[model samples]
Target: MRSLRQTTARWLAAAFLAGAALAVQAADPAPIELAAGVYMVPGTGGEPDPANLGRTGNAGFIVGPRGVLAIDTGTSYRHGQALLAAIRGVTDQPVRLAIVTHTRQEFLFGAAAFREQKIPVAMHQAAADLMATRCDTCLKTLRSLLGEDAMQGSAMFTPDIVFTDPLALDAAALIGRPIQLLHYGHSSGPGDIAVYDPRTRTLFAGGLLEARRIPDVGDSDLPRWREALRNLQALPVEVIVPGHGPAGDKRLITQVERYLDQLTARARALVNAGAPLSEVADATAMPEFATWDQYETTHRRNAAIVYLRYEREQLVK
Candidate 1:
């Protein structure tokens, strides 16, 4: 017969093991099938933290006849490993390529993992240049927020391919479906790009689009961003996989445009009124987007940035 203390210790050990298993499962939720061979691994929306392990941006993969093409990787080395595991769960095809969709920290660090597997990573040259300038600092900040354990083995890497102009994968031979990397200059960010898969009519709008979330405008050119949206609006996109929110339809493009318009208009008015920069955030309150994720923080920052830009233009004139 086992002693009472031994029985209690064994039960506690089993419970701890079970709890650890649950934590792993929570970090890696199942990938959502957006189309026949396209899958979206949804992010837990909002700011990155220890709870979400910095997976605040969505990642996805497209399975092709030749192999697989991965969309944005997650925020850390562990996050990238989890994404790769999710891809493996869905298909046996090797990942032939991984695209860092934009210049966001959440999507870049994970390239390290894919590169380790001997997969080539690609990004727009402009975005890569921007990343080289400041991403090390961003990585440190993320490590402080998400903890070292979550970020271990993560490091910055140079992209294998960088192109200035729009590049199209040989759809007929590579993926069995057309995939285009669309670049609209200096819009959402430097060299912001979107991936369009024609067969699925899916648009992977990197940092260029958001749904039910306040778009980050810290590095945006409002006018150029709007122009890019106009270009995207003409696409035959049936589905949109945004940077930070749930995947949706073409209406996501319109929603982003509306937000940008309203924000620019409000900020311009404030500048014209000679409202001080300190008052921009509070003065340009967006009640309609009050319920959106990061409205309080991101929206306020955006308002201030836009106000300053308009203020500068006025001074130049």
Candidate 2:
């Protein structure tokens, strides 16, 4: 097991280089109280976590008179604990519940820190199923990439609460914080759940909204994703928390919406033109986000996803 610091250092180096080359340096860790009871935990400049390295870990806290409601755990168990500790330092209130915004390995694995508290860790049914089946593989890959200890302890995480549609939790009751689970179809993951705190106007937007780096289109439905972004924009969101990147403003939602719109159009054009996969991959260019650090790698992957979707559509038709 590599020491956590070592892993951090290595990732930092990678992040620095990637950011510099792309001109997207890590933003400082700026913790902001977005809503009356919500706070945004930003990430410092450095290599991003292996799961979503380009974007910062957009974790947040929802505090009420009762206790704290953790939005999404950070990249590693260590990061999650740090986030947890940060919450504790601010308030002595117990952490009542943790709502995972999606199934991304980084966001879900941090549940270990609060395991002993027996807090109800909840995730969408699709997310829970993915974790149950592929967690071991994810753990092995993470250990190889981030070192064994870079993770919390175990990759096994089961959501105590699972629901298909929107579920509400009252923060005052300690039953859990009042959150609306909107599982938009194949947005970030198969089960992308967005947690909205009306009181805070803070939206924990899993992987749905990538602020800068080319939006990860993997497992994304281009049409639905574009629609989801528009829907998100319609919400009363002041502070936006992304799954992999820093806390953002409404601009994050706008950027993702544009990316989805343009990428789908470009990919569809290429497919209709009878372009090959390699041709489509090479021909596609991310719209006007080249300088947004970490765009190179993620852009390639995004284009690949677009190409794949186009091919899939052809087969279906």
Best by lDDT: 1
Residue pairs in clash, model 2: 15-47, 26-45, 55-244, 55-245, 56-244, 56-245, 169-178
lDDT value, candidate 1, whole model = 0.82
- Local accuracy of candidate 1 as per-residue lDDT tens digits, 218-317: 9888789999999999998767888877776777888888889999999999988878888889999988889988999999999988888888888899
Clashing pairs in 1: none
Q: Which 10 successive residues of model 1 have the least lDDT summed?
A: 14-23
Off by over 4 Å in 2: 1-30, 44-56, 168-172, 175-179
lDDT of 1 at 111: 85
Model 2 worst lDDT run, 10 consecutive residues: 21-30
